[model samples]
Target: MDDAVRLESLAKSYGSGDSAVTALRDIQVSLPKGSFTAVMGPSGSGKSTLLQCAAALDRPSSGRVLIDGTDIAGLSETQLTEFRRESTGFVFQAFNLLPSLTAEQNVALPVRLAGRKPDRRTVQQALAQVGLEKKAGSRPSQLSGGQQQRVAIARALVTRPAVLFADEPTGALDLTTGRELLEVLRKLVDSPADDGLTTVVMVTHDPNVASFADRVLFLADGSLVGELISPTSEAVAARMTELAVPTC
Candidate 1:
């Protein structure tokens, strides 16, 4: 499989000398196109930092980050902005939708921000994929937690980005709702509609949530400690317990 993202000996640190703290330590990982991956770790393990660095939201103090064979470290700030805008999609625990905009409008915002006109048909299709077609006219306050999250997912996918980085995307929803959302994300990554190019990288502490991924990476103290492919909730939970890692 082709690599959508590659990180080699990546490191991030803060402060200097005695006050120095390392957030990520010589991390190396690769995400293949169309694969769904989960990052699991205890608090302070640098899972979030890894995601931020991989997504270009934060820079590493050393090493390399590549997206589609292009080293992100070589891009200027303006070029990085363009790269992120055109190649990455983000979903956070918070819906982050504009309160005044309807679901459809929020989903269309990215395309508009890129100086392109919104295509109504594309917006509708994206919303429909997440089963939010009927609520397309609803504002964030008008929808339930799950509905709002679905809208967020729709927004992330509308631009057809090469990679989707979701930080605890299902954190705010109930079990059934979170499961539904995971299914939607799984289908989005695995289905052919994305042209076999949309890679998914999610940070999650829930074993059930991690079960939805093709692979689960375990981190300890800012370094990768283990990996599980074709994981199950029970199996992952057992491993987490063995490692004394807390779950969400």
Candidate 2:
């Protein structure tokens, strides 16, 4: 399968000389198109750093980041901004929704920010993808945490990005709500319409959340240590235990 994103000899550091602290070192991994991948590690393991570099949110100190076959490491600020605006989506732990705006309006913000008039139909469809079509008129404060996150997901998908980067997406939800949200994400990967297949790379500390992915990649001290295909919650937890890593 073709890679949605590929990291080659990627390394990121905080400073120079003796004060320098490396967050990622020689990380090499390829996330396939239309696949769901979970990244797991203990605290300060650089999982979020990996997501940022892969999504082009931050530049790596060295090496290359290829997204959908283009080398992003060399793109200029203007070009990179255009590329990210058109091709990538992000969902962080916080909903990042504007409390004053209705869900539909919030989803439309991305398109509007791109200097384009958002198509009402397209925004509604995006919300429908997350099963929040009917709640389009509700504001973030009027909805539950899960619904707000769903709105965030819709906002991310509104641009029809080739890749979606989610950082601890279910971290703020209860067990049932988180599981429901996971199911929504899983279905999107498994079944996409209009060739809207989206490759998902998510960072999470929960075994159950990792189990929702097609594969789980384990990281330790900014290095890829291991991986598991068709992972289950029990198996994932066992491996984390072997690594002596705390889930939280």
Clashes of 1: 0
User: Among these predicted structures, which one has the highest lDDT?
Assistant: 2
Candidate number of the best TM-score = 2
**Among all windows of ten consecutive residues in candidate 1, which has the lowest summed lDDT?**
189-198
lDDT of each: 0.90, 0.92
Q: In model 2, how large is the Cα lDDT of residue 12?
A: 92
Measured with C-alpha atoms, the lDDT of residue 158 in candidate 1 is 85
Give lDDT tens digits, candidate 2, residues 145-171.
Answer: 999999999999999998988999999
Error of 1 at 228 (Å): 0.2
Model 1, runs deviating above 4 Å: 194-196, 245-248
Task: Please give the lDDT score at residue 116 for candidate 1.
Answer: 97
